[model samples]
Target: MDTLLANITYAGGAVYIFYILTAIWIIAKKNLKLLSIIFPILALLEGLFIDWRWGRIQDYGENAQIVLGALPSFIISIGLPFIGFYIHHFITQNLPKDPMIDSLIEKSKSGAFGNDDYPSIYSLLESKIFEKSSYQKAIQNVENQKELINKMIAVLTDKKDDWDWKFNMFNEYKVVFTLYGTGGSYDPDNGTITLLTNKSGGFMNYKNPANTIIHEITHMGMEYSLVRKYNLPHGLKERLVDTLVYLMFKEDLPDYRIQQMGDPKINDDLKSANDLESLNSIVSKFVNK
Candidate 1:
């Protein structure tokens, strides 16, 4: 029974050592100054406890026997924790932030970036639309929207080649005309894209004909499940990407300035977000509507 008790005591000491080392590694890798201070204190306590228990074991044998039994306990209780903590700290702090996570989240939001990639009449005709026309003027307008969509996709997706993107179109269509403007939804799964031109807000702008088209394209890129959308609010990865999209394209969209629509400090506030809650706060300021 005494042997069993000693073994168990040593094992417990080792485990505590392991935990302390892991914490130390975490602090070092993250350069977390506060944790650095706390870690040594914890390690000291663990060492002290091990020493106290090992001193008690001396009653079982001569000094040499007690020393032999206590050595393993000292190594585990005092050494392992330091090693684990530093290892964890090194790996975690060095891992790169994921860009794809941000892309997925930005794509989920409805905004100008999402609305930037519209197909040109020429390209659509080559792929989906058929026939040439004496209506040269309308064809020219279609080409303009296509350019706008390409630029928007480039800015939002962080890809330079708009023409390289994959696209498919659904044969059916649905549309909505609201007081704010006309809008539509596109379904990528079924290859269907819809348009609702507010008789007043159709693709008429020479400067950004692609805006509506790109917006609908982005909607099509949404993940098929509503559960994903609902759960996204709880995550940080998407928010970071979405934040990147807005920051990259804000110059093209002066009307949607953070200062005009949100607290002037909104961007600054987001710079500190190392996780999803921070990202969410930034997104809410811009896209909660």
Candidate 2:
């Protein structure tokens, strides 16, 4: 029984040590500085507890002749820090933030109808005349929306060489106007951009519909390349998309400056400009090299 107990204690110590080492490795690889400090301490405490339990089991009687069974405990002691670090690192990495839609809301809020250029876009949307029949009017509305979207895409592509390259990658890319749902979404799998015309305060709510269109198309582009290239986390990817929107359309649609400011992921520690510049430098380096 004593031999079995000592083996069990040694095995427990080994498990803790293994976990601690794994955590340390992940933390160091990811450059998680805060976790690096916390994990080691946690591993230490766990190792001590295992040792204490082993000692108690032995102290129960005279058959506890394992007086110098301290080597395993000592080894576990070395691993405690790594365990603590791994826990911290795992928690921070996996903690859920606001949904992807919430990030989109933050990015699109300033441009929504009644906000920036919505009134003008709404007026343009209303200007088109169609047959009085409901079905015919809906069909005409869709056609007019497509014409307008094409015009905007043309302007954007003409202005930026990068836009042409990105937009042309998906040959069958089409924008469909929907009566409900989000401001816009790009489905790379289908090469479609769905624009919400109603439900979220209506399609007219977007201040710069052109900017929204461009932003969504940018997603289609980045979805193919940067996402795969960087292995960017969801939050970071949304921030990068926002940064791209800002960089591409800031001069054309100054209202996008508000959208840039509203990104929840932006912080004093992680400036959007710096992130944008870093990504741009990386892309430029890759292309030039």
TM-score of candidate 2 on Cα atoms, chains taken together: 0.37
The C-alpha TM-scores of every prediction are 0.28, 0.37
Q: Which candidate achieves the best lDDT against the true structure?
A: 2
User: Worst lDDT window (10 residues) for model 2?
Assistant: 63-72
Off by over 4 Å in 2: 1-168, 199-201, 258-289
Q: Candidate 2's residue-wise lDDT over 119-218, tens digit each?
A: 4322322332111221233223444344444544455445434331243334334444434223455556544455544323234435545556666666
Alpha-carbon lDDT, every model: 0.34, 0.42
Q: How would you encode candidate 1's per-residue C-alpha lDDT over 172-200 as one tens digit per residue?
A: 21221111111333344532333332223
